[model samples]
Target: MPRGKQTDTKLTLVSQFFYPDTSANANVLSELAVGLEERGFDVSVVTGQPAYAPNDRRDDQPRREMYKGVAVRRIFSTRFDKNESTVKRMANDVVFFLSAFLHLLFKRDEMGVLLLPTAPPFLPILGWMLSRVRGYEYVPVVLDLYPDMAVELDYLSEDGVVYRVWDQLNKRAYQAASLTVTIGETMEETLTEKYGPCETAVVHNWEDGSVIQPKEKANNEFSRKHDLVDPTTILYSGNHGMHHDLESVVEAAATLEDSREEDLQFQFIGEGGRKVTLVRMTKDRDLDSVSFLPYQPVEQLPESLTSGDIALVSMQEGVEGLCVSSKFYTAIASGQAILAIANEETEIARIVEEVNCGIRVDPKRPGQIVSAIEHWLDNPDEMRAMGERARSVFEERYEKEEAIDRYATVLRRVTT
Candidate 1:
């Protein structure tokens, strides 16, 4: 832990998002950088200006700053609107890619290891290209599988030339990495099948128990503000993006409109492309039991998360292995029972079963979803037990300290 020895163990984390940004990726990378810095490793982050806020930017912010003993260098990139057109988004990605490439190229000697996540989806390729000559250990963290996600979402055809080219690049990136890190075993399995065997680690994303813990709704600000006091709240809080199957939840609400108890409610907090559709469906079906709320600030996350009786975690049909919901960990830490609307065989479902934290209902089955919620409502004791078990398992396995240490260990192993 000497200063001189620490200088030789420098780590450079490259991502499009970082602290002061509200994105989940930003939070994850920020925590990792700070944790690594505390462990006596010289850590620096190469990121872009604050741009994740929809249609906003801090144009006057400085390009460089020191945050909590970690060196943060923000690159100059196009400050396009966060919800811009596809061409504009790609341009933004290109600008960051070029700017980050230059920074890493010049500072390659000092960076003993590079941790790059697939934010822009071009970063792994950039690192793979540089590692050929730079000789720095490249560790690619697979947050979401590219090209496959696009194809699954119908943005690109699997048989198209673009898909084929991107798939090949993705393969090369995984192949070049000294160690590939993904959040769940399902994602790791998908990567293995797609690119053949590679050195990979399945480190689940974690939550800070102190930051997001159980709180009584009567004392919770979010619950009181939103009048979420009486109902047994079924909360879906996070990005309602294309990767999630929120329609099933809406259908479940409509199905139980008359049969559900008067005190039962479904709350959707957050915004994305699918949110509009969800809102329309609720109104068109005259589902009075449903309520929509904008995403709460991070400071309010604890109260908002704990306001729910059961937290809903969902994934679209084909998106099982492509991405894991980070909200799942936070929901567990919130001490709420989990109702996962995904494949029963998925990693999230497996965790729910192993911990006895909640139930799994396939998103394609609205009846099953309704039944699961109703069953939980009928058995309050079982629900309370599940919530208790959720917090216990979270502290034992998904706490921030342990997960970050595991990540540090993986980086150390690959570099040494």
Candidate 2:
């Protein structure tokens, strides 16, 4: 059946990253564009070249192509190593923003409803500016709240001039948007509280259960290749950014090592600014049970995700509503019980508690993390049941098709 009424409105998705970029933001937007296209909307994506993967630069990829029935336009931008330096990353974002603005400006007549994701944190401001000039509707999808996130990370002071200006700009853009979308209730609350009451919708981030469902470790090739078959593995399989509480996780592992938990293993996958520090910490602690690996290919996600018995999801103590981890949905979809290290106010903690699918620990308490792991270790059957429940909840509430449909509904309401 058709997902929604076929519409003539041209939907353009704007972001710094998109297809061929392995970042969670890129992957989600790519899927959304294709899903909208499949639902009978004319969809186009304007994104920069692949820069998320350090070794995978796609400067040679065609500037324009029809990818999975969605028109994709790759804009020219600096492909800096984002993990290496903050300045270089900002340079890349600035160039992408300028280039995207120019590209969209020239195509103003073709623009209908602009779907903006906060990749560079200020991308929604561009959408707002374009909407004002072209009299077109734009929906700002709040992936990560800016200025506030920067403030929490200590990248910007709350009282700084830059923070004040950015926060004011954010308020203006969100208030002017036809509809603002947030990925979780906590985020929606934060948005409305900060900007005052405005049109907003909470659509949780999701994963394709059909693609990332449970698989036996013995039968999984990636698991076997990585030697993840034997131990009760705890996996942290996403960006190790500054916003995440990875140090607590490492400390928990160290504590577990001290307890002589020989049957437990900690695996860290994917790379980010904090990965180097994490690797050094593991080595300095002589954590033989801990392992670090680069991100696996997309095709191997099913195997890689199911390789672990527990999935570690975390965030820094104070940045609860600023962003939600996409890895949480993927973990549930892969039928892995979550070991969430976050504040009680976070969406992850709320869901874990509501569904009884996993355990939540305070990010500030490494001992709580260790205790949670120990609980799972002691009650293996209960842990397996939790994993099963996680997958069930994912299928019912957070599947990829369901999220895309909600997005379609939002787009329809905004455009009409």
Instruction: Estimate the TM-score of every prediction.
Output: 0.95, 0.97
Candidate 1 Cα misplacement greater than 4 A, ranges: 1-5, 55-60, 82-84
- Model 1 — which ten-residue stretch has the worst lDDT? 1-10
Candidate no. 1 TM-score: 0.95
- Per-prediction RMSD in angstroms? 2.0, 1.5
Candidate 1, residues 1-416, lDDT tens digits: the string is 32333545678899998887777778888998998888767888888887776523644456789989889888888777644456777788889998888878867777778889988876888888788767667888888888798888787899999999888987888987999999889999999999997899988888889898998888988898888888888999987888888998999889888886558789998777788889999999998889998877778788987999999999888887888888889889998989998887778888999879999988778888899988888898999889989999999999998998888788777655
Index of the highest-TM-score prediction: 2
Regions of model 2 farther than 4 Å from truth: 3-7
Candidate 2: tens digits of C-alpha lDDT, residues 1-416: 46453456688998888888888888898999999888878888888888887745745568999999888888888898988887898899899999988888868768678899898899889977887777767899999999799889888899999999888988889999999999999999999999997999998889988889898888989788988888888999988899888988888899998895467789999999899898999999998888999987888777888889998898888888899988899999989899998899999999999999999999879899889988988999999999999999999999999999998888788765
